[model samples]
Target: MKSNLLSLEMMNGQERLHEALEMRGFLVKKEGPFLMLASGSSKRDLRSLKMLLNKLHIPIFWNGDRFQLLTNKFPVMMMKKITEHRGEEFPVSMEGYHFRWRAFVNRKNGLKVDALDLDPHIACFVKAVNEAGIPCLAGCDGHLKHAPNLQFSGVYSGAWFQIIQEQYLSEFELNYTWNVEFKGGSGSRLVASKARNERWDRHKIYEDTLKMAYKLKEHADEIKKRKASSFKRNAGMKEEAEGLRTDGRFEELVDWMERLSN
Candidate 1:
């Protein structure tokens, strides 16, 4: 029973990741959702591999990636002990958890950032494991800008990897692909849109925001005159207003507006 007989099921949006690994000489066998890695694959420096994958915008499947590193015997025994497997490590819902959005400034660079609320379940699990004398630790998953770095508290240096500077398509670029789809009984017409300079789009967005702000101000006045409505309407209005106010380039937009007024 060598550890090489491990199988990991790759989820959706992970095909490119699998291909990337294979291209790198990893002995990976894709059998449906499961990916079987050769022996000694896990013992290698996984963080380095994760760092490369992060540059490609592919994250390891929640717990599946970590669990594959364990010996088959140990994983099997743990699975039997837990009995309630499947959804324990990750949420079962196809849809993601509805985490509350937050806005704050990054302490390191003083840049305004948006993030989601922390998962309480993770804390509870860590406490439970520690109380059971399992010596469990909590750390970052090293996704995207974060390195695949994981360390114990005693020896942890909370350093993140430098952002990889490469000409790659981001989520914003992918938005143009949404209108690109195959028609029924017709050959797919894959048309790549002409790339425009980002500055052009940024200028347009700033102008649109100024126009929207005026419209929202008018709507806010109208709402005041109307009868009281549900909290949903109020919350929607508040969120949009806050988003515009907190935009990182908002100060520059204000200057543009002032110049236009002159």
Candidate 2:
């Protein structure tokens, strides 16, 4: 593994430090109040960078987004000295295509867990599914060499099945085609189909997948709204029945009770 320690030592400011780290294959970005670092695709680089940070006495912690430098751990003067330099802030938009972070709650202990950064292409889809109340178990962007896919849990419900079927059949002929495979009790997988040996159109797939994600979210929201409306109507009827009973209107109470049963 290559080390950026020597070059970092020679760096006078944050700009220089950022450049040195980048040259050593680390992705450096500003996230909120902290500087964040990622190793991109290299485990060796990540290990080397972690070692260098430890040697420098910089406290870092993984915060779902990236390894964030704990600037507060240092004295104010020392922190200012080390972090004083400015350059263009890292782009916050998807144009940069950095991996996305997600936080999951551990069911066993109910503790918040940080998930590994997701591939940029499929991250939004995963987020959409999750926000729509379906659990996304895994996803792959296919690295442009195969079909990108997402694995989901609890997709056997009638509503989800219908939505998946509609999307799968409707998007079949598109450049970024979609397929849904049901695994019975195991849940379902949504695949962005690509022919063997055909490189995926990453940008196209990203755009198409996002559209599909929006559609799924819309359907999920509609279902939730319908359920809520049904529940509210039922509760209102029950309240009306109780009011009728309390008012000694036996005929009205019976009619309300019969309506509720039906």
Candidate 3:
């Protein structure tokens, strides 16, 4: 086992990940339902993956997409300067697939009685034990096999977004950690968390979100358009309105224009 772990560390990052998955019982082929990649488990990786997911167009409520993320998501990447504090978790990252099938499924976040943050390697074994991600952490007290160094845990909040069974497969050969999950998620993400939140007007919320993002991209254009226009026509715009409404100064000018038009 020590030799295997050493060889894994010696392998390039991607190879280490694939090897780990295979060791855990998954058979990796050149052509499979998914292709996996690995990267730094650093703060940069965490932030980037978070953004990717936040902007991803996949619909989580659907079974097919849920299957995709839960199974194929990459390990969570967070860094702690202190070796003891440093731990990792996983999040699904599916592309070219759809988990609409998840719409037919119903699941909840792991009972969060006492959520925890532990080593990534140990977390995989926990996943192995529960046969589901319903438990936030699996103890590293040698209760599980193949991971002696396993003494920590953490979770993916998005785990509850959707859960699918088909895309969820395992090759458990005595507890090795995989770098990523597989066979999950169809891309082209649209925000669905909004719909999940009680305070949100999902449709209107996301519409405005998208509008704001688009508006940010065309900042210069909005500025030029507002400057060139003689008549301001944005008086009654909804407060929720996003985008560069008549250049970047739309809000500042709205009151004056509203008074004039009235």
**Candidate number with greatest lDDT:** 2
TM-score of each: 0.19, 0.39, 0.21
Sort the predicted structures by TM-score, highest score first: 2, 3, 1
Model 1: per-residue Cα lDDT over 1-262, one tens digit each = 0112333332222443343243232334465555554332333425534544444343345344541222222233222222211111221221111111121101111111100111211222222212222112231222222211111111000100000001011213222221211221111111222235422232232222223222322243232222122112245544643454345333343333233223
| Cα deviation of 29, candidate 3, in Å | 9.9
127-203: candidate 2 lDDT, tens digit per residue: 44544444455566777777787665422222243354454337534566666564423245677666676777866
Candidate 2's C-alpha runs over 4 A off are: 1-116, 154-173, 184-186, 217-220, 226-262
lDDT of 1: 0.25
Which residue segments of model 3 deviate by more than 4 Å? 2-13, 19-85, 88-116, 132-137, 140-262
Tens digits of per-residue lDDT for model 3, 227-250: 224222243432212232223333
TM-score of 3: 0.21
- Model 3, position 190: C-alpha lDDT score: 15
- Can you give the lDDT of residue 238 in candidate 2? 44
Model 2: weakest 10-residue lDDT segment is 104-113
